[model samples]
Target: MNLLKKDLADGISFSGEKDGHCITCLEGKQSRNYSEELEGKCLQLVHSDVCGPMSQESRSGGRYFLTFIDDHTRKVFVYIIRSKVEVFEKFREFKSQFENQTGKQIKILRTDKGSGYVNRDFKNFLRNQGIKHELTIPYSPEKN
Candidate 1:
């Protein structure tokens, strides 16, 4: 430290202080919390998410996929589509089939606030069905 100060140093300070908000260390930390608990019965709280627009397509030319999971049963239903526009249609199909088989109407729909779930058509459909729609905060996938 003395040699560095005397020989080649310009304006460097050698303090023993620590940075509490060190970006390098913070960036390396992963979140370590368990997800929120799932409550209620089958068809009472349904969670849905849409994924992809991948570069590679399936044999049927599908590039997007949608998933519906029952909170109580953890039963999942999935559908593959060619585009986002088919989201409402897939929801309708899932709702009808699941409700018919389970004999219980879906009470709440939980999803991230993506355009597929927040659009006018989807909103109207949920409203007409009397199903409450719950959206997690934007950019927080862990909340979903």
Candidate 2:
């Protein structure tokens, strides 16, 4: 403290303050406490998304990939496809496999409001299956 005072007195300047003993800068900073609700296991909540039409196609002639992520287990299922049109079928496959493997039904289906998911057939299927379907607000994945 004396040295810093002397330096300032002598018109010496530094970019930031340095405590001689600690060799660190002191600056105004802020932090916040963040809390999150615990997430349940896989087969409990799944996140689904579709990605791509690559410049180049895969060996299977797939240009896109559909992903189903088990939120709790962090296990991911990726299905390659040539179009978004396959999302419904791929979702069905995921639903069947996940249900069979875990012996637990998918309680919710979440996805962006893509045409593939909002069509009459898809809406009817979800209604008939008694699954809760949640769609993200337009142009927003954070809401999903």
Candidate that scores best on lDDT: 1
lDDT of 2 by residue, 13-130 (tens): 5455555521333332433222121234446667777777788999999999888876766578999988989989988888898788676677777878876678887888878988
Runs with alpha carbons beyond 4 Å of true place in candidate 1: 1-40
Each prediction's whole-model lDDT (CA): 0.80, 0.72
**Tens-digit lDDT string for candidate 1 (8-67):** 544645433235333443555655332222233667888888888888999999999999
Maximum-TM-score candidate: 1
Q: List pairs with backbone clashes in candidate 2.
A: none
Cα distance off (Å), candidate 2, residue 59 = 0.8
Worst 10 residues of 2 by lDDT: 30-39
TM-score of 2: 0.66
